[model samples]
Target: MADIAAASHMSLATVDRVLNRRKGVSSRTIERVLKAAVELGYLNPEAHEQLAAPRPPNIVFLLPMGTNPYLRLLGEKVRAVADAHSRDQPPIRCFFIDSFDAKALAAGIRQHARWADGIAFMGIDHPLVREAIEEVGASGTRLVTIVSDLPHPARETYIGLDNQVAGRTAAYLLGRFCGGRKGSVALVAGSRTYRAHSERETGFLSLIEELQPGIEVIGMREGHDDRNENYQHALALIEQHPDLVGIYNVGGSSDGIARALTQKQKSGDIVFIGHGLTHDTRRLLIEGTMDAVINSDPDQVISATLAHFNGVAQASTRNHHLQHLKIELILRENIPLQYV
Candidate 1:
C-alpha cells in the first residue's frame, strides 16, 4: 500500500480507497493507482487488463410484439442474459414493436438509435426499413439482424439459422415421413415480409418440386403468427384439400395448427413440420401431432450478439461462427428432457 501510494504520488488512504474500489475516488486517480500497481508488479496482468477495460456500450434489441411462443422465449432469454452480465457487459434493453408495420418498425429503429450505441433487430425486408438501417449506419451506430435479415449493406452481422437449409430439411422430413404416398401439402407463413420466412418457403417449394414431385403444394396462407388466425387457416386448408398429407409452417403458431388438426381428427394422420421448439410444440410432439421442429438456440444468439459488442478476440471468433446458427432438429424421440 505504501509503495503504491508513493509510486502513484498519493496518500496511503487514497491508495487504500482505490484498491478497495470505494466511493469518492476519481477515475483519473484510479487509473494512476492501477498504472503504479502494474509497474510495481503488485497487480496480476489479467486483473489489470480487466480493470483497465473500456466501459461497455449500451445496446438495444428490437423484437416483434406477437403471440409467437418462440419469440416470447427469445425475449425472456435476452432479459436473463442481460441481467446475468449486468456488471461487466453492455447494458441491454429490449423493445417489442409491430413488426408487420414497416413504417412503425423504421420509426422504432430510428428512435432507439438516438441513444443506443448498438442496435439489433428482427429485420423486415421493406424499403423504408432498409432506408432506416442505412440512415442509422450513417450516424455511426452499429447494427445487427437477429432471426431475420435485410439486404442492406449497413448491417454489421446477422445471427440466426440458414432459413433456406431449414426449409429444405423440412421438405425432406415431410416427404420421407409420408412414405412416398401421393398427396398434397399446404404451407402456412407468419409473413413473407420477413426474409427468413420467404427464404424458407422458397426452399421448401423448390425441394418439394425437385425431390417430392408427387406431393403438390396446393397454396400458402398468411396467419401473421397469430394462434386464432393460424387455426382458421389450418382448418380452411383441411377443408379445401381432402388429400392433404403434410403441412409445413414456416413461422410460429404451431399450436394453432395442432389444434386445428386435433379438431379435424387428423392430428396423427398428416405429416406436420414447423419452426421453433416451445412448450406447445413439445406437447404436440409428444402427442404425435407435430412430426419435427427446426430451431436455433436463443442463448447462443444472445451470446453471439454480446460477443460482437464486447470486441474480444475469442468472442469475435465465436460471433463469426455463430453468424449462421446451427439448425437443431427436434423430434418426438429426441426432445430434450429439460424442455419436456
Candidate 2:
C-alpha cells in the first residue's frame, strides 16, 4: 500500500479506498492507484489469490451470430478467453443470438437467467431489451452490455468503444481525405438498432455537418452486416449519387463496400473509412480499398468483462468510464503484421 501510494502520488488512505472499492474516492485517483499497483505487481496472480479464493462465476456471453466477421471474431475471442481460464475461472458460455433482433436478444437474456451468474451481450437499443436487462439485474444476475450500451443504469458495465467518438473520428478522416471535394458521402451500418452504430452515425453526421457543411451525407443505410446486403446498399448508394466522394461504414461488412467501390471503378477515387481490423479490412487497407480503420480490441473487452465479474480487485480500480477503451486508427503502413 505504501509503495502504491508513493507511486500514484496519493496518500495510503486514498489507495485503500480505491483498492477496497470504497465510495467517495474520485475515479481519477482510482486509476492512478490501479496503474501503480499493476506496475508494482500488486494486481498479479498472488494479489488476486489474496483478494479472494477463485470463485468460478458462471458467466454467459450473448453474441450476435451472422456473416459479420467482426461479430464472429468477437465471439471467437470470448470463447478463446473463456477456454484459457476455464479451469481456474468461471464457466463462460457463449450464446449466439440473432443479430439486430431486440425481442430475441431479450428472450435470450431472460431465458439464460436460470443458469447464469452474469450475462454480457451486444444489445440492441430497445425498450424490451432494456427492460429484460433490468429484470435480469433485479434477479441478482450481473448484466453487461458489450460493443454497445442501453440507457444509463440498465447494465452494470459497457465493454466497447465510445461509438460516437469513433464515428466522429471516422468523419474527420473521411472528410479530410475527401480534400474538400463538393459531393455527397454515404454511410453504411449493420443496423441502427445497435446502439454503437446509431451513436457512430450521429457523431459522424454531426461532425461532417459542423466541419464540412458543403459535404452532404447522402443517407444512412442498414446493411445488416451481411456482405451481399451491404453490397446491394453500397451499389444502390453509388447509383443514386453520381457525385459520391466518400463512404463511412460504421459497422461490419465493409468488404461489401469495397467490392461495390471496385465494381463501380471508384476504389481509389472514393475515400473509404471503416471499423474493425479483421482479415478483409486488413487486406483492403493494404490494397488501398480502405483509407482508415477505427479498431477496438475484442480481446481486451473480454478480459475486462471477465475481470469485472470475477470480483478482481484491480478491475474495480481501473477505468470503466464510457469511451475509456482505446480506439486505434489503422492505416496501411501502421497496420499490425498479424490480424488476430
Instruction: Indicate which candidate wins on lDDT.
Output: 1
Model 1 agreement with the true structure over 1-340: per-residue lDDT tens digits:
8999999999999998777654346779889999999999999888777766655667899999998999999998888877777556678888889857899899999999876778889989889999999998787677889998885667878889989998999999999999988999999999999999999999898798778788899878999999999999999999989999999999998999999999999998999999998899999999999999998888888888877866742222333233898999999999987664
Mark the regions of model 1 whose C-alpha exceeds 4 Å error after superposition: 1-53, 312-322
Indicate the worst ten consecutive residues by lDDT in candidate 1: 313-322
lDDT (CA) for every model shown? 0.86, 0.83
For all predicted structures, in order, the TM-scores are 0.83, 0.81
| Candidate 2 Cα errors over 4 Å, as ranges | 1-54, 312-323
Worst 10 residues of 2 by lDDT: 312-321
